[model samples]
Target: MIHFNQVSVVYADARTPALDGVDLTVPEGELCLLVGPSGAGKSTLLGAVSGLVPHFTGGTLHGTVTVDGRDTRTHRPRELADLVGTVGQDPLAHFVTDTVEDELAYGMESLGIAPDTMRRRVEETLDLLGLADLRHRPLSTLSGGQQQRVAIGSVLTPHPKVLVLDEPTSALDPAAAEEVLSVLQRLVHDLGTTVLLAEHRLERVVQYADTVVLLPGRGRPPVIGSPAEVMAVSPVHPPVVGLGRAAGWSPLPLSVRDARRRASELRARLVGEPPASRAAEAAEPVAEPVATVTSLGVLRGTVPALDGVTLGLSRGEVVALMGRNGAGKSTLLRTLVGLHKPTSGRVTVGGVVPHRTPATELTRRVGLVPQDPRDLLYATTVRGECANADVDAGAAPGTCRDLVLRLLPGIDDDVHPRDLSEGQRLVLALAVVLTARPPLLLLDEPTRGLDYAAKARLVTVVRELAEQGHTTVLATHDVELAAELADRVVILADGEVVADGPTADVVTSSPAFAPQVAKVLHPQPWLTVHQVERALGAAS
Candidate 1:
């Protein structure tokens, strides 16, 4: 469906091509998973297919790149609109209509499709993507995952033959992501539509991919082939892939089922040295009160957003704040950070009232990374952004340079923070806040746009910070991320804490928010795949 032959793309100001003499062909109806570290140019490659690179983005192009045998350079995005449909990271940013059903029909109306036909397509899409129940809901009322699905449905209603998605599930919960991926699968297997996606959550899609395209770092060659073939040798492997590598298994397994099947046979075939004994079942860390809210309550307009809710974060702990959208999670975080002063009850951070302290003083001890990376970044260069953030940290000039380099080694110092990819900018903004070494850290959807490696980096960074006695709080819809990284899992429902306990105790109790692994391994207290791998046979 798409072919690139010695295709190199260079922005007018760029010193080098974003894609370097790349050569590859994607067969019709193939679901190709594009995987790589940040700034590996996944967006650049996808833009090439949709005529956004050299055409919309104003870049110099060389060699041949074609979509459905039509030259990309000649066919701009509008020209290729009917040929391909794209869904990006921020679905709300792209939405033009107010309601779900209308949003789905927007694309069809643009293509001059008849009203009757458009209605039928919208109905089919509603059922296919499981949005029939939500057909009348306002787009603003939907959750992050539901909004992203609406974005996909909006594009699919036009019945485009080629679908291009860039990090479609980065902002959704695991269940939401599964819905989007299932839609993509049906589009390919049932409808014979070709699918090309750039995503960070490999666990959701890698096992089913017909082709995998791994872009080499900025200056290297692109590796493209079957899932097992490319992943077997890739230096940057997913955790499960890493497990296969450590286990010395041939024909690397991408999913746990495959791993289990192979491990059972390998147990008999080999008497290799047992891997180092895994960590013992860790005792639950004592929860200390870092920031406590006693009898806290707040009202939005007339409705109470939070009511008599008592919440606390402990020193040296990762607490995952789980809830439905508009369930008061954001309100609680904002209130804690002094953005929204609580109407009642005492809120304390490090035993000091955040509301009573000066804003500058509060920021010094507390770091809050917001949901939209755009909100935090307002500087011309990545370095400049970090420098501005540093003025509060009382650090010498250029202090953020080393700090950013430490946390985000993949980011170049010169690029504008806004110009980087969604995931890149997110991680960069996060690195800026960490420069302060705040005693208490607050993050909202920290892993939204980050890739697998980036997610792993954030997990490690948070773990290290907690071990150093800094309190960490994360507001996320990603249950899997919560299960893996959180020491204490707190579920928020309608603005009050509905459930609270150790990660194993809370997440393992609810199927709605539990990690997929919990379904297979019952009676397992471990919340992470890494923990499971390290403690293999310890339970047996």
Candidate 2:
């Protein structure tokens, strides 16, 4: 029961409309997925539903957006609070209270609901999102995934008729993501809530979508249809869709199980050909360790975030740190950059303890791109940010700008850093970190908002850095990226290293960690669609 009639949104000084002449309708009780490349007006469309587009964002709206018989043009976000709930990409920006339980009840309290009713809804939401155990925990102390759940719960407690989420599962681990999606499914089935969401990790949510909306960038009209119909022509898609296209499968499958059911003959055709080995190319003689952790232990509010974890990174090595939510992946990266002091054991970067080194000295030797790219960005314009980055890293003026162009071509130099899309912001942050030419680079969730084209650019830049004798360690939940770029995979669980080995060994052996290509071509050892395409091309 959401309708956009001839909707067009243009920011104050933007040359083109973020959304142009868009007409879309989401029927009641249906979950519609908005899919597109970065900067495709997906976030703008979501904002329109909750009355945040022109109202809070200071933009001009050309047409009316109505939700449940209420025109967003007439009702502000606060007026539509009972009928709409919106969660933006950054969850930390949404929280008003410090603790999980208080955040969940805050919305209902604002709505002036009875205290008893608010309490009942709070308990129900806590159980629905699996946040019962973390009810008392401070929001700042929780993991990214945990904070995401709390953000969602705070909105869900209002029992709104519509839920609009931007990348709801982006920060969640596989299992946690599944739980969140399952909750949405229940809401659509039992509660008759209208759910509209945008997610880059299409593999996790495409199969569950009732309708798919494709917004080709550059002010193109939106395409609306079933998942298969849209994915057949969509430029950005998951590995399963790519595999389906490569093999000429009719009606592309959306999930791994569907692809596996149709993969028998294709697997047979590639029987004798093995995928090319990325690990072999990366197996050069190991140089001196760039960073070393010996029995590292870190405590977060009495919880052991990292427990006796020992790891090493050699010069020119590219390692990926992977694990479930709250499994110590982010903690390890922070430890290397000296953000978290180890409660026990020691960490040394460039042969000196990271915690003991001065901030300026440590930044020269090691640069970190945090999970939230906004942490590294504060300047108003893109050019200003790059200039500041050059000054901070002691590099030439144009060094950071050149890297930004390489990572994301055609980005406007005069645009505000906050106005850029999530992916573009990430690319800018990466460029800022790379300006110093640090011996070691750390990226946490680097590809969270990137499209396929942008991700390919990142892959090339990361590989080039390794070739120049730089050590790179990235913490990620994107399995497909790790499969394509990582020389080695290190998995942590329960604050300890559970598995550490070559990329092939670590990813293919675990079902949860395997990419879509590996899942479809199991026992064949192929990890990426590109690898399989290359092998088949060579054999033919």
Candidate 3:
């Protein structure tokens, strides 16, 4: 249903094209997955399908792109509204209305659909995406994950023949991601809708794809094949695929069920060898408490975001706050950073109350890299942003820039912040916060836009910080990251703590939070590909 004819896109004053020599066709009723590292033109290609690339982005389109017999060059996004629906990387930018129900109906209203038909689709989309309870909530008041669902539901309500989504499940929790993917699966299977999506979180959607498109950046052409075929050669892949390669399995597995079927022999090989103790690596004398929360409670409007949450963060511990979407993870992070005033109870960082501390005083005790990295960035260029961070934190010159280099090397100093890829922007924001050198650092969904390589670098950086006696608390849905980086995993639900313990104990005991490695080699205590590889190496 979608065809790209020798497509190459180049922006003004660019030395290379964002996409080059891409020629492919996506059949109708199929879910096509786009995979690659950051800056791989995945977003550019998705934008081209909805005519937002050359049309809205002000780029030169060298070749033709057709969707459902309508050429993108000839038909703008508005012209193809009935045939195509698109949700970009940033969910906040996609909303046109203030409320959830209104936003869902806005697209159909624009298309001049009858009121009755629009209402029916709105209800169906809300139910399909598990947004029925949030139907009347204000867009700004909802959590990041909730806003993402509303953004998706808005597009789905139009009943477009084609859906173009960039990082559709990036903001969603595991179960919520599954629900969104299942909705797309149903659309492709039952309704014959074409789905072309680009997501950095391959573990969530790689198993659902009917076809895979790999876009190697730097003007390289795209490679198209089946999911297994592409993942076999793709540099970026999910943990399950990484495990398959490590185990030398024929026909790499894309899902947990498939991986488990072939894991018996490997499991026997490492029968007695326990997985590496990630928590033990950080073993030390119980350090002083860096932050303490005493029966914290926060209310957003009338909704209880956090309720009676008591927690303690040590000076050198890396803790991961995890749970379902709207489980008060972000709210707790905000409370620690002093962004939200507790409705009841108290929060303290380094002996000072966070909510009551001055903004300048709070920076020394704690820093937060929020879900949207752009909130911490204001300067036009990367260099300027770093310089501004240095001044704001009262740090020496080049402090922030050096941290950025450590996190994401080879980034151009002159590149505009707006021009940076989503992953780059997120890394830059992290560097900006790290410049403060706070005793406690909080990261909300740190791996939202990061590929595996970037995420690995992040893991290393966070580990280094923990070694230096800094406390790190990351509220995330990326279970793999928690397994690899978190010394302890704290699960929250309904504004309260549900589970808290060592990474292995909390994750392995819970099926929903287990990583692919843990799931594949179940009844065994393994959480990551590195852990399994280490066990195999020792046995040999």
Identify the candidate with maximal TM-score.
3
Question: What shift in Å separates residue 424 of candidate 2 from its native position after superposition?
Answer: 1.8
Full ranking by TM-score: 3, 2, 1
Per-residue error (Å), model 1, residue 34? 0.1
Task: Report residue 6 deviation for candidate 3 (angstroms).
Answer: 1.4
Q: Give the whole-model CA lDDT for all candidates, comma-separated.
A: 0.77, 0.91, 0.91
Q: Kindly give the number of clashing pairs for every candidate.
A: 0, 0, 0
* Predicted candidate 2 versus true structure: per-residue lDDT over 246-352, tens digit per residue: 88899898999999999998899899888888856555526688999999999987999999999989998989999988899998999898988889999999988
lDDT (0-100) at residue 76 of candidate 1?
79
Candidates, ranked, lDDT: 3, 2, 1
Evaluate residue 419 in candidate 2 and report its C-alpha lDDT on the 0 to 100 scale: 90
Question: lDDT tens digits, residues 335-386, model 1?
Answer: 8888767788889887788878888788877888877778888889887887
Candidate 3 on 456-513: residue-level lDDT in tens?
Answer: 9999988888888989999999999999999899999999999989899999998889
The Cα RMSD in angstroms, rounded to one decimal, for candidate 2 relative to the true structure is 1.4
Clashes of 1: 0
Model 2 TM-score, 2 decimals? 0.97
Q: Candidate 2, which segments miss by more than 4 Å at Cα?
A: 281-285
